[model samples]
Target: MVQKAAAILMIIILTLTAGMAGRQENEKEQPFLVQITEDDPSIAYVLVRMPNPVGLLPLPTEGEYTRTIRQIMPDGSEAVNVLHLTPEGFWMEAANCKGQDCVGEGMVTLENREERVLWNMVVCLPHQLVAELITREEALAMIGQ
Candidate 1:
């Protein structure tokens, strides 16, 4: 009876350990998406799915890159914004719009999205541009993929 009980306990322990490991692996496999939308007649749209890191270490830093979004305002003027993107997060690098509030919105990342004032979105009111970090499901639905 004692040996049977010990064997059962060991099996349960192994099962639980395996379950935890699978959960961690699934979390690491999950990926996030970034969407940039410009609400103007020109209507610029961009959707980027960031790649998941391999193992525990990050997917290496490539020094950061920028995507320029341009829109034509109703007043016949052009609005421009440069968005800085990375595997970990993104932020508004520069903008030609007035007020400069979008640049102050700062980076949005998976880890800090909940704590951020704007959550997952950075808005440029003057330029009518919005950059948001969203889940894969939401992104797929948006693009009808």
Candidate 2:
């Protein structure tokens, strides 16, 4: 009976320890300062601004992910844009615009979490599309929050 009790105690301790470790890992992940999205990338972005455009919806600077968006802007214009998120930064892979200006905007990323490196814009006025790197503070401001 004693041996069985000891094993149960050990299992309980191990489970608790694992749970604590997982909580710590979760704490390390901070909230996103910026978001790239089709819903609302945020109008507060100063580097590039458009009334209402679409495509290439991405969310924050996180793990590797790819997204393709086709947005119909307020002007009835449309665009298809592709976006990529890398550990190094965010980049534009493709954009269905006449000038293809957004395609050349390249990657906009940070050297470190606090470091500001790239603040560029990829906009195609004809298609009413705009993609740009905006600070977290700027993003919050655009929505009036």
Candidate 3:
């Protein structure tokens, strides 16, 4: 009887812990931050904007193409290559900051998560800027309005 009671207590504790963990994870995943759809790939453009403070930002990868857009400093003193992204890896070219995060993030895809999540490639840049992805519905919404 004691053993059975102990097992039940353990199970209850584990269940409660798992529920808390899941809630935390869900909180981390903000729905407004991402907008994914099951539409054409040619019309998709993932937009990411890094927050202030950090000048350099990592880029997002989608499909086989990657684009790097150089950005000017807030003060307009220098044109720095702030966004560096690839299909499998990303790098910040001009920023001298040292961190293993950009290199650690390997190739990420959008279609893989389309069925599960709304946004596939939305990510914050190194400087805390917000990144946005333009989905078909979003684009249509913008054009229609």
Per-candidate TM-score against the hidden true structure: 0.56, 0.47, 0.35
Clashes of each: 0, 2, 10
Worst 10-residue stretch by lDDT in candidate 1? 50-59
Model 2 C-alpha lDDT per residue in residues 16-124, reported as the tens digit of each score: 3444454434433221232345565333232322323211233433456655444444565645666665545556688777778767766665443244233455555
TM-score pick, better of 1 and 2: 1
lDDT of 3 by residue, 28-62 (tens): 21111123434434343344443321111222335
Compare the candidates by TM-score and give the number of the best one.
1
Alpha-carbon lDDT, every model:
0.55, 0.49, 0.36
Candidate 3, poorest ten consecutive residues by summed lDDT: 51-60
Cα lDDT for residue 96, model 2?
76
Best by lDDT: 1
Order of candidates by lDDT, top first? Answer: 1, 2, 3
User: CA shift at 35, candidate 1, in angstroms?
Assistant: 12
lDDT of 2: 0.49
Clashing pairs in 2: 36-58, 44-142
**Reference-based TM-score, model 1:** 0.56
